[model samples]
Target: MAAKRRRPAGKGAGAIGCAPFFVLIVVALIIQYWWVLLIAVGVVALTVALVRSTSGPARPAKVPPPPRPQPVVAPPRAVPTGEDLTAQLRAHKRISRVRDMQEWDYEWIRLAHPGKSVREVNDIANTHFARGRSIGINWGDPSAP
Candidate 1:
């Protein structure tokens, strides 16, 4: 195989060709105000130094370590079990019984008056049952457990 051609090293014409422009500026420096020449030389030197120092784009900075995780804590209370559930149900039943006992006076007065007929009470219960059934049908659910 033929030998591979080596690429040229260092800056090409684009870098070296600026010499004529620099020479012209130096010549003008001799003719013009000294302060203007000084400023121009300073700016040119700063630019050349910056370009030479940073020839490539900057790389991304390295990331620092993440903060350590904190330890987890749990509540000090115990979870309710089947016995707790049964106790809650017993409490609800006690409350319901108290309410029924208080309402018994009104039920006794109604029974003494005999205002509502058994047929009327049955009709009302049937209507309520029908309404509950319709609601259950519409929702596509089984009867409440």
Candidate 2:
């Protein structure tokens, strides 16, 4: 007859094999003093909770409230001077030669004139230049004329 061979115990198999032994010991202890076991379990739970609370980081006492916003006050509009107007007109002429002026260009012009449209500003600048105004801009070009 051949002798029987035993297989090596695995990690899971060893823990599973010892489970019944541990359960039997616990059963015997519980049978002896059930109240003591219950008290021990409660004491362990309280000690764990106490250690966690004491060992962890401390919290802030109180959070600060958000600040209230102040009311906005717009500054007064500056009055454009004659020299400023002349400089702006010259610049406008140069820009108009390159590309057709946009709404933003007219809006900028309206900043100086307050209520004039793009066409009105163009007419006004042309008439101002036509009347021999030396605004440092060349108005002799046939394309512009």
Candidate 3:
């Protein structure tokens, strides 16, 4: 029995590559029509030269030397002093103290009574002289039933 042979990658058995054949055809074409190609190339070059020479506006060949690069002046870097940092901290601390306590007082009360509004809670809190925190704490107590 004859052994089977493995074909080389990118080609079939005994196939001639198309590249060499295409190159030969192109070379023969160029040799046969060299004068025509030369005339075409001369025409293109002449057209380009005429177009460039007679372009509408005679533009300045060397573009007016680009405006001298402006000296880049970076902003002065700021270093925060202890006083500035403390002032910022004081401002943020005051804001959080004022806002967080107010929000916390209402958030829990609202959760406990879905239908209760800010005015109702505020009125009730005022009546009992108690903020929502105490009432919410009592409601949250699992043992209170």
Candidate 4:
């Protein structure tokens, strides 16, 4: 013989039974004093407002004043001496032989000829390097004897 299936108890049954009870209570309260419903709605709105206001950081009603601008002052420039210039040139030449010169090389040359453009400084530096080469200045590998 096959076993008979027993139904699951009290899942939706409790909610169905409580629904009528809740409806009756609300109806009784409405009949007794309608103003109570309005008061309940007002209290719910007040509660929501209080919760939202306290939930996060408070914002200012007006925007804060724009930040004050800081003054920018230029530092004093130092002039390179003849010995300093010669030393810098020698250092630059040693570096150039190792690798092809870049924009930074022209920038270094610009430090010596302050008013000159990058192209002009490059030309001037190239002339100096060429002149050194013609004079047989050893601007190659320092490791070489």
- Among the numbered candidates, top TM-score falls to 3
Q: Which sections of candidate 1 miss by over 4 Å?
A: 1-79, 104-145
The TM-scores, one per candidate, come to 0.23, 0.29, 0.33, 0.25
Runs in model 2 with CA error above 4 Å? 1-18, 41-63, 68-145
1-145 per-residue lDDT for model 2 (tens digits): 9999877676445657678889999899889999998999999999999988785577768978888888888988887789998998899898775343333433444576967777889876666545544223343233444
Worst ten in a row by lDDT for model 2: 133-142
Model 4, residue 132: C-alpha shift (Å): 17
**Candidate 4: tens digits of C-alpha lDDT, residues 1-145:** 9999886775555646678889999899899998888899999999999998785776769978999999988987787789998998999898885345433444456786888877888788787555433212243233334
Sort order, TM-score high to low: 3, 2, 4, 1
User: Which should have the higher lDDT, number 2 or number 3?
Assistant: 3
Clashes of 2: 0
Error of 2 at 10 (Å): 6.1
Candidate 4's displacement at residue 7, Å, is 1.4
Q: Which regions of candidate 3 are displaced past 4 Å?
A: 1-8, 11-16, 60-145
The global C-alpha lDDT for each of the candidates, from Candidate 1 onward, is 0.65, 0.67, 0.71, 0.69
lDDT of 3 by residue, 103-123 (tens): 665665566667887788777
